[model samples]
Target: MATFLYRIGRWAFRRRRLVGGLWLGVLVLAVAAAALAPSGEEADLAMPGTESQRAFDLLDERFPQSNSQGAEARLVFRAPDGRRVTAGENRATVADVLGSLEGSDQVASATDPYTTGAVSEDGTIAYSTITYTADAVDLSESAKAALQDAASRARSAGLTVEIGGSALDAEEELGGTTEIIGVAVAAVVLILALGSLVAAGLSLLTAFVGVAIAFGLVSALAVPLGLTSTVAILALMLGLAVGIDYALFITSRYRDERARGSEPEEAAGRAVGTAGSAVVFAGATVVIALVGLGVVGIPELTKMGMGGAGAVALAVLVALTLVPALFGFFGRRVLSRTARKGMRPGGAARSRGREAELPGRDAGRAGLGARWARFVLRRPVAVLMVAGLGLGAVALPALGLELGLPGDESKSVETTQRRAYDLLSQGFGPGFNGPLTVVVDTSESGDTRATTDLVVKTVKGVDGIASVGEPVLNRTEDTAVLTAVPRTAPNSGETKDLVHAMRSALSGVSSGTGAGILVTGTTALNIDISEAMSDALIPYLSVVIGLAVLLLTVVFRSVLVPVKAALGFLLSVGAAFGVLVAVFQWGWAADLIGIEQTGPVMSLMPILIIGIVFGLAMDYEVFLLTRMREAYVHGASPGEAIVSGFRHSGRVVAAAAIIMVSVFAGFIGMNSPTIQTMGVGLAAAVAFDAFLVRMAIAPAVLALLGHRAWWLPRILNRVLPDVDIEGESLSRHDPASSAPSQTSAAEPAPVRQLPVGRD
Candidate 1:
């Protein structure tokens, strides 16, 4: 099969220039379209109810006073010495700081506290959520720049400022992941990596096409679905990875085949027969894993599942058809020998089956695959114990993982904001700002329970709160919001403590006539989000596992293939989570990853890792399985197939794994801590899958299963669907497919190796 593929790749090269031009054009158009198209996130968020906006929205309607930006910036100042805040000198300094902030360059009109009706009764902390008054009419570039400049000035003052809201964070996070219009980094990177401008150009081209097609597909699905911004990033990255990975696999194979002897037409045919089939199966596995997202059933997760699935599907098609179609057109130079046509490349081609061959195989001891299998077969128990123990040790860290967002280091908050936050905490309690909002509505709009028994009990017992405010009578006198001020920042553990306290106290609030109470805050939101994600995980995993099995079963015509694949995938998943727990959650790799106990991986990290790493893992799974199946078809026993398959596919799988690991690990250095977590998790998963799972476990299982591994009920086998994934027809040499005499036009050949024990 390998030889046949080489023949077809040679033929494609002889006709390179034309196929090259076509693929180039298609790729160029795809990228052009994606750049112009609005992002999937922009479309959903362009309207209302798209974001999981917490307290801010209800605060807008129910507590109108609490919602506006009129509170410019909190100013909390203390004397530099250990002096109490009441000193006249301290007051003077505080007043001076306030005056400076109000009079600063960016303050369009810092609210006059006495006049604006917004100020704390106490003198310890004062703040106004600065309302930037940039006009809507100033939609020009200059206006945007002006707003940016003003923001810069505000931060540069360095008053320990915090913008403290979701809108700004959302904008910032999205902006970080969002593609700006000016540069195409993927394209440029490809150009540099591929050495030849045309090959690099080809890589960029396929990826753009993948993105363009993925966008249309993702956007169409969003009409009936919902997913978080995290999902969008997942899909984009998958699309690009598959896009480049697929093209590179085939391109590399085709080049090698051309160097062997085939001309343009034969080479193209062989490339399709060999690499094209592998690409199809690889993409299928990825899509199947992504579909698991739907099983998880979180609306956003589902959206991600659907979007990623769509992107994988599109990437497969584009990689196979458009890329190959392009190759068919540009087959000439695309396959020019890495050096020159006359010279040996000094790679696998020169080293195969010579002095380089291991002595055991040549010394009447069978091959390397045989000798290794013999060794492992002799001590299966020992091998299993060693491998299992290693996996367990690596997985230990996952036990302590916690997930949450930390402060954005980029924001230049004013001293006023920092001082104010500290003052609020110090004066009130740790849960001061982390209050649980409970709105009590009364029928009379007059006298209601000013202090519900439940509220009083709850606040008194809560750990984080310094105190609860008495319900203030509104103008209606019908509705009142009892604020349970926390002793810590809203994002802190104290906030969660407050929520638990309220839950326990709800019984007290219900005493006598039931008062309407709704608990809402940052803590409540986090709890809900975490629950949703957990709820979604099982089903998502099931879906991915099931689909993967189904796809593998069809491709390999063996039930064991899917089962073995799942086992391998899970081993790697466990290993990855364990590493994350130790490093991010336990701070083991703080120096290397540059984080200090960031906590459990990001909320979305688990799901994202499951999909991407699983998909890529399956890529190797398919690649390795295909070789084994081919050998089996040619009459080799399962043992022989496993040996040759591993020996032949191991190097490629490791190379591919390294490349993917490097790319994902790149994000460990990204500006955002979240991306850093993702980088670490993904890179670790790939490495584990490649070396530990793929190299060791998969082969071990197959070795043990032997011939029974491929068994399927005859009924299922006959009725099951047939896919030309390995392009069997292309591997065969036929007179009708005759071409120029200069190159071999052979099709994928039959496999032929014996079982390990028997041989």
Candidate 2:
């Protein structure tokens, strides 16, 4: 494997221009294809096999008149002077607004509040409902513009008007300033690490270009795959972080090679062959974890997982191919002139002079990183217990974790959706924003009215019931629909409990009346989605974690090592979820980050976070352990190898963690609460994984385990494939090698089955 990758690296170096041109061509093609592809629509987090889906289907089939198939847009109208909206002039203005909305080609039906009694009891506020022919995510640009134009006309009048719901959400533009902030921070970290502006720029450019290609591809896939627009944003976020980190790993190795006086081509080739292999492994782990998100069986989550996986895969390819090719093309110019000169034997004095001027230049290899590793080793037991307990403590809050979809309350209060929600809650009740639709089937007995009355009576007796509207009989008069509004807010735990209680209570009525009863609507659907995701979480975790352990076992040729890695990753992810629960659910100091409201974390956040964080945690594991494995294969003692691995790979992991955190933090600047919540969760996960799991607990555990850390069963080792992730064979074959192998010629062949003791 090492030989194969080395040859590819050499070939790329020899034909650098062609490789560079090929990538550029692919980039252009990607852009054009993406631009020409149809835009994708967002899929609701609806589970087809669930009770909520059954209820929705029954309603759509048996009682179409009860509600539109598509989503509804609410238009809230308030008199400017706090006058009653029912006043003659105010009513006239509202009528004109509804008239304009009714005339819109986008609207399937527009309800008049004056006749429907959709006005507030105080008469100061009223809202009309517009049901579109398609869902907001499926609406065309022309339709959206028309809706906007109608709203503008309403605002032109003396009435205060706001249009809300899925329509406005569909039109919301997530900002890029957060990404820019992330990039800016990444660049500064790169410059500090590389000590060369050109090198830092190369890393950033490589990452940016890779992410651009991924964004284009994700956009292009949207139409064909029915992906949400948020997929592109997520792809961009993952792409930027992984792309830069992959490039940094390769670039850092190349710089190290150049410093060792290797020629540019040799350095690029060796770097690509060695660190590039690790990048491939790390990136593949990320891709696998992301793609595994599909197991949850939610279409939106599947698309997001696929999009993120695709972006990371492309970034890995670019890191392995284009980055090295560029290094070949630029040669010594890739490094700063001062750094390049310092590599010369005669320029030792000049290098010393330059080192005095550069802050981190001399401290790169033997700084606090090495000292920290040594410090941990001195008290491995103490370090292991303390770090483990600390992480467990941090993760304790997750025990009380509550899962639900974020509602209008989580949105910016300034948004039209929030305004509409507030007005409705004020006018009717909090439950008005999320009505429960009960679908009754009486085709057998043909006693729809009797069943409806029974169902309504049963629902009214439920604990959380605020009100039950009159039943709307279907055209066949064999089925009826009832709307039940609960006192609790849509996303509240009480609402979900009430939904379950209502269903249980109605079961008796359905059996007695010989009719089918189903609870459906936004509130019921959200609860169903949450339950589905929660049920899938354990299985999803098992798959991703199980796959990770198998892959790490193969790569590291160890049983205990993989076990430790998986457990550590779980700890990191748990801590991240704990933080998420605290900040988003409990609103613990949420105001520090400018958050004004708190709510339940998104339903699928746990699965998404587990998949993402598990992969990333393994990235550091692979990079660090591969170095230790390499050292062990070359005859270093287990203790020496652990310390050496830390010294060698710690710096890169630190830099990569910083970059990832900054990138994720950028999404906090987005207007969407979903995005912001995800940003914080991912950022916290990376920080915990890097600082606690990898830096502290991993080394401590390994030190305590001694050589047993790399032990693998002989039977399993024989079946597993031999994967060379560090290019050890290349090092052996090279005749001009400046660093001699530490392995004795009498030593056994380097393979998965190594003795559990020093040679």
Candidate 3:
């Protein structure tokens, strides 16, 4: 393997200029390809199971009701004296308001014209619902503006008004989230690339290239594959992440190797061979991971699976092909400048420097490397125990993690419209703050009234209800959507509680009433979505774990090897998860991340972490274990191999972890809470996986497992395909019976393996 790698390194040196020029050409092509790709409304769906595809799909199907939103936003008045206004009085007031609203160009439709709206059955207050739909083949920006202008004019007419619904909320969230995500992405890229701002910019550029291409590919698939608008942005986010990440790993590795000893071209070659291999493997693992999404039978999932993996695959291609080419052309300068520090760009040299400076080291007989290894060896049990304890402590906070609405108006960016929302929510009550909806529907709208009343009565009688407002009635060209306001805040548990209350209350709602109740709200929707996610995730977990097993089994050709790899990976995940619980969930580092004590980590974050970080944890595991197995096959005892492997691989693993951490740390300051969470979780996972999990627990467990660590059932062994962990095996392939060969070689000698469980 090294021979092949070395030869490739030489080829890069020989054709430096040619390779360099090729990189330039490819970079341009890749960028151009991405640039021409579709985005936003132009992009195709990346997710499956979308009810409506286009941003305006809702309006299209309900063209009859698109104007409904404008009407929904019209003034609603109640007497300030807290007394119910009479029908006669309301009629007079509504006439004056309607006349003025008619003069306005924004009002597309109104329920009341010359007379007052109907009085409540209680005869306290009179109310009406009106819509303004200014046309532009859709809701035009100018038209919506004019509509809002007309609403403002009506408000000045003294109609107590409250406007809240999906359209207004969607528009607000879209604008806020987009601006925030953009600024966050840019901030992360620039901050990390500070010393080499150009590299940071290039990283962002690379990300855009990947994102654009993925979007275009998704768009092209729209005819055959249905997708949603959210899918586009989701795919775009993943594309940029994988792209920058792919390039980041190799570019840093290349520079590291060059700084140590390799010539510019040589460094590039080595990087391509080693880091390149890792990249391919990483991309494959992610692809394997994303492929699991296809199992959900969701078009959106399949789209995301394809588009997400496609982006990463494209990124790997760029990293391997274009990056090396760039190095070949800019070889001399990159090498000269970075090499001035006395190392190569493969990252191996940089690590060596760090190893020499590690704490508790010796300059002589028991060298620094020797001492650190021995120290770990001496206290294996203590180290394992302490590390495990620390991990557990951090994870405790996860138990308390709270899930809530993405955010409320408090989290809303300051704007007049936002201010209006704050006022509306406050005036109406927090249930109006963020209520769960229970839509009442039947074959006939009239039939729905009794069931609706029943549902409302049941809801009002619930223990948690401060109040259950009458459902606001509306009908689409086909479907009807009712807005239900609960007594609790939208995201509060009380909201969830009230949703439960309403569901139980309405179970018998239509039994004798001749109406059926279909309860759906953000909270209810999330509950259903959560249930769906759980079902989707069950197979996903199995698939990911199974893939890990298959990949490792192929790489090591031992059932025992795959099993061991899976276990170690799990331990790493647990440790990382624990840390997340401590810092993010428990506010351990609240001062640093600037989270300032929030409810809980994002619900989806852990799932993402498990997939992404576990794959990453596997990265170091593969690197270290390969070298160990090589030693074992060449004839070192299993124990000896673990010791020597840990020793030889320790510095590199630690250095790689640190660099990965540094690169990811750049994201900690990003504006997006999601990305920021990812950055912290990833960094923590890498740190723990490398130093504690890999260095300490893994070695201890393997040391204790002894020959059994590589054991496989004889029948299964014969059937399971063989992969050469660089061709390492016990004497006769029986890890239990065969002892390691003490073969002497030109490479570093194997350190003595401790007894299976002497620690």
Candidate 4:
């Protein structure tokens, strides 16, 4: 693998113009396709095989006028303290608002509160229903503006008005100041780490190009593929992050090679051969975890996983080809002035001698990583215990984690939807915001009315039932639908229990009446989705963990190292979940992060964290450990190898982790609760995994294991294909590639054999 990559990298560097033009041409074609493709529609949020989804499909087939398929808004109006909404003047204002809403071409119908008996017992609060002709995403902006205008007029007429519904939901505004800030932070980090503005800019440039191409292709295919905006955003986020990091790794390696006296083309080849091998394996781990989302059987998640995988793959390709080609153009300019000076004439010999000195000792110039590695090596048990205890403490809160879908109740208090939700809760009850629709199909029953009555009676008798509305039958009188309000909030655990209890209670009615009965609503659908996510979590974890262990075993050619890496990943993910539950569920320091409301964590958050964090965790594990294995194979002691690996790769790994965290954290500023939760969760996962697990626990474990850390059973080693992830084969295949100038007579002899079973 390393030999092949080396050849490709050297070829690309030699023919820079052709390689650069190829990528540029691909980008242009992607842009043109995106521009010519038609706009994509939102994917259906349906959970097939669930009772709620079946009920929805049945409603659409049998009762088209039910307006269940269209978006609807509830305009809640509250009169002044001493006035009632039914007062002559207040009634006129309400009538005028309804009239204006009905006049809009987008509005299918608008009902008056008086005629619909939607007024509160005190008559001070009332709500009118406005149904739109199109779905929420299809609704025109002008229609929303008209609704807002009508509400504003009512407010001026001494009535407090607020509108709440799916029609008001707009696509989350992405690629603005938040993303720019993240990119800016990443740029600064790169510049500081590389110590060259040109190097930093080159990394960012390649990453941006990869992201643009990936996003363009996603956009072009979204319509036909049923991809959502969220998928595109996810693709952009992962692409930019991994692209920059991959390029940075290769570029940093190239500089190291040049400092050791390798020629420009040779340095590029070695860099790509060694570092690019790690990048490909790391990216494969990510892609494996992402593509494994298909096992969850959710269409949206599958699309998102595939989209993100595509972006990461593109980043890897760009790093292997474009990065080397760019290096050819920059040559020594890719390094800082001081670095370039250090590589001049006889300077490379002096630098190489200095680097080849005692592995763990660099006199007074030893780096922080070197010092930390020595400390861990001296007291591996203590370091492991401290890290373990700290991460365990952080993970304790995960035991109390609850999952649910975010609704208006989870929105900021300042949003009109939230305000309307609160007002409705105050006037009616908390359950009014989340009414469950009971759909009864009685086509097989001789007495439809009797079957419908039995369903309503059974539902009303449920423990959590607050009220059951009168059953309204279809024109054929074979199907009846009713609304059943619960006594708890939409996202509350009690409401979920209520839904389950109602289903259990209605099963008997269905059996006796020979009718189909389903409980469904926005709230019920969300509950079903949450349950589906929870059920899939175990299977998803199994698949990804198995993949992680298998992939790491092949990459490192060790049994214990893969096991240790997988366990460390679990710790990081658990800690991330704890942080999520602490802030989003327990409201611990929620205000500090701008969380206006707190409830259950988003249903999809846990699965997302596990899949994404597993990939990223493997990234640090592979990059850091491969270098350690390289040092070990090159005749360094286990302890010395740990120090040597940190000395070479620690700063780059740290920079990459920080860049990824920043990109994810930037999404915290988004107004969407789901996005905000994802941001905090992913950011926390990366931080814990990178700084604590990889830096401390991983090295400590390796130190404790000593020579046994790299052990692989002879039988399994024979079965597993040798990937040569450390580019060890490159040194053997081309003796000149291993610079003799970089080694000193005092240093230990290099081990020529494969390092699979060092013990």
Best by lDDT: 4
Q: Go through the candidates in order and give each one's C-alpha lDDT.
A: 0.56, 0.80, 0.54, 0.86
Candidate ranking under lDDT, highest first, comes to 4, 2, 1, 3
- C-alpha TM-score for every candidate: 0.74, 0.91, 0.68, 0.95
For candidate 3, write residues 167-259 as lDDT tens digits. 243311222443345435554544332224444544455555566666666555544555444444445545665566556556655654543
* Candidate 2 structure lDDT: 0.80
Alpha-carbon shift of residue 464 in model 1 (angstroms) = 3.8
Name the weakest run of 10 consecutive residues (lDDT summed) in model 2. Answer: 348-357
Better of 2 and 3 by TM-score: 2
How well is each residue in 427-461 modelled by candidate 2, as lDDT tens digits? 77888888998888888755778778888889999
- Flag regions of model 4 displaced more than 4 Å: 36-38, 64-70, 345-366, 732-749, 752-759
**Which digits, one per residue and each the tens of the lDDT, describe model 1 over residues 590-672?**
77755743444556677767887878888888777776776677677767777666554544455556556655665565445
lDDT per residue for candidate 4 within 1-759, as digits (tens), equals 898999989999999999999999999999999999866766556778899999999998789876555777889999999889999999999999888887695898988899889999888899999998888777888988899999999999989999997778777788777778888999999988887899999999999999999999999998899888888888988898899999999998887766655678877898899999999988988888888887777778889889999999999999999999999887767886667655557433134441432121222223877888999999999999999999999999999988888888988898999999999999888999999999999998779988888888888889988899999988999889999999888988899999999999888888887898999998999899899998998888888888889998888888899899889988999999999999998999888777888888988889977887888898899888888988888778999999988988888899999999988887887887877888899999999999999999999999999888888887787899989998877765332334354355333356834445523
Candidates ranked by TM-score: 4, 2, 1, 3
What number of clashing residue pairs does each candidate have, in the order they appear?
71, 0, 35, 0
- Candidate 3's error at 210, in angstroms? 5.2
Best by TM-score: 4
